[model samples]
Target: MSKPDKTSRHGERRRFSPSMLRRGMNLYPPFLGMGLRVKEFSDDWTVCRVELKLTRFNRNQQGTAFGGSIGAMSDAFHALLLMHQLGTDYHVWDKAAEIEYVSPGIGTVYGRFEVSPEMAEAIRAEAAGGDKVLPWFETELTRADGTVVARVRRQLYVRKKKSVTERERADFTG
Candidate 1:
């Protein structure tokens, strides 16, 4: 198959495959307005960054990046990480999410979402049985000054199709 098109024109590593729904958030006014960047991604995890620009400033607040921006980043992070673990066969979608704002934003905010070993095992077990809601996790968005601005917990429902024994090695898509 051909390589998926890169998601950004500015040379950010924050690219996504065609199957990634979070990529569609680029069209969202709230997310796009925050200038979120997918700086890096691999099979294990994803790192996303965002800057609080004047456009993101509501009421001219300099310290807090838009709450929506932090939430959106959290959503994208968990969704993408789950996708990596579940692959394309099992449709994974966000079931629920929560964010806690702990402190004011200082500078560029970065978030990282990682698929845990236990979660992977749990997901595999879930698919082994049948389609089911795998698991959910929490991630923190922090500023350059080391202040955690928000904690986001994301829940996802994963629907399994063919069992691993039934599908080819390469049939798995994510």
Candidate 2:
């Protein structure tokens, strides 16, 4: 598959492959410390799977996964997935999140984040006029046996960047 159509702030093309992102995420200090691993990323950047293994560093008094670790494991993935899908022409950020813990993650918990083509297109269309669009996404944290451990809901803020001319006009008016 081809690389995503991403650009830097200077408008130059940038190469940020899914594999690179996965490697970086895995190496990140917080994630690494908590035994979190980005196990897989689809070539299209729409799907990401993360796993949190039970370890001393991430275990709580109950000998299960720490709540913070569970929350962190499911955080930012939706925004990251959407950012790559929307490219650099737009801004994407995590606006809010809520997690409902259904069960203690005894051994290992898995979470999958996905932003379908239709969802991406809808966000793009909604924000095409330079207005901000807030979209909510939901997923489940499950165990290897397919038992649900937690439910995660995330909201993202997306907006199209203003054209150079528009920025100049706003600057002059101000």
Candidate 3:
């Protein structure tokens, strides 16, 4: 599979560098309000680590992490990673999500997301035919000590852009 052109589904060039994305995510209203901070975002957009600190703003009545906040930790990342990897020719979006609370999140918890080259290749192959593909991914929210706090499952919708498909058809027929 070829590397993506770093354009959005709207065909605009992606302007944010990895650091910029990390900073932007940290300041993003919902994340900021929920005490979520992106600790690491790799230059290749393949690996991202986010930390959720238990604070008054995101604490439940039981004094643990808010369920909404925990769910938020899994939002947008899989789609973002796959979009960047698949480039302008494809559209990627979060189609569905589910979070299973394993334990009360106390103190600080972390969520890590990774998109391997093999995974990207598989997705590209699956979406090459211009049909939408829904792929599921899973990650864990863990405590500082690596105890599981929650399990998050995300499904992303990916499809080749119609323009790309049309252009390819023209190339073949013309």
Candidate 4:
């Protein structure tokens, strides 16, 4: 028996590729039970597309996609993207989230989450000095024909870890 390597080929902690992330998410119970599938993840980790299909298991009693399923589909992507982008040196968490039910979802509904380069850069810069930064991201769940069924907003808290030297410097400056 051999121990599994936790580091990537580059000697850094193994970073989850889009495919890997999708596969792992599919196995998660909440998503699995709801038929939420990760349809796509961009190579750069900037974009993620998720879809939920209406079925007996996931449909509401009124015969539409369940609100809980829609909300679950909206969760996690923003934080996941930021965590990978920021790497091991930073802490990223989903501080808050809100979802608005705009209309009933029918058939297959899609949700896409994207973080622009500018937004990523802004988060990095804001957290570089060891201060917490809150960044908000929004996405919509839509039907196959592009009718929005819901809107979701997520706010993330991010902060860079301070090294001993940086901590000492801050202490002296204070």
Q: Write the per-residue lDDT of candidate 1 for residues 1-174, one digit (tens) a residue.
A: 876545332234544453354456556676565676555455334333334432434323564566666666676566666665555556777889878889765557777677765676578677766657647787777877778888878887777776566666546541
Cα-based RMSD of candidate 4 = 4.9
TM-score of each: 0.66, 0.91, 0.86, 0.85
Sorted on lDDT, highest at the top, how do the candidates line up?
Answer: 2, 3, 4, 1
Better of 3 and 4 by TM-score: 3
- Tens digits of per-residue lDDT for model 2 on 1-174? 875546633354646767888999889998889999999877776899999999999999989999899989878888988887777788999999999999999899999999997899899999999899999999999999999999999999999998899999999999
Against the true structure, whose TM-score is highest? 2
Backbone clashes in model 4, listed as residue pairs: none
**Which pairs, if any, clash in model 3?**
none
- Model 3 per-residue lDDT tens digits across residues 1-174: 875556543456787767778998888898888999998877677888999999999999999998999999989988888887777788899999989999999999999998886898899999988899999999999999999999999999999888867889989999
Better of 2 and 3 by lDDT: 2
RMSD of each: 8.4, 3.1, 5.7, 4.9
CA lDDT, every model vs. true structure: 0.62, 0.88, 0.87, 0.85
Candidate 1 clash pair list: 14-38, 88-173
TM-score (C-alpha) between model 1 and the true structure = 0.66
Q: What lDDT does model 1 reach?
A: 0.62
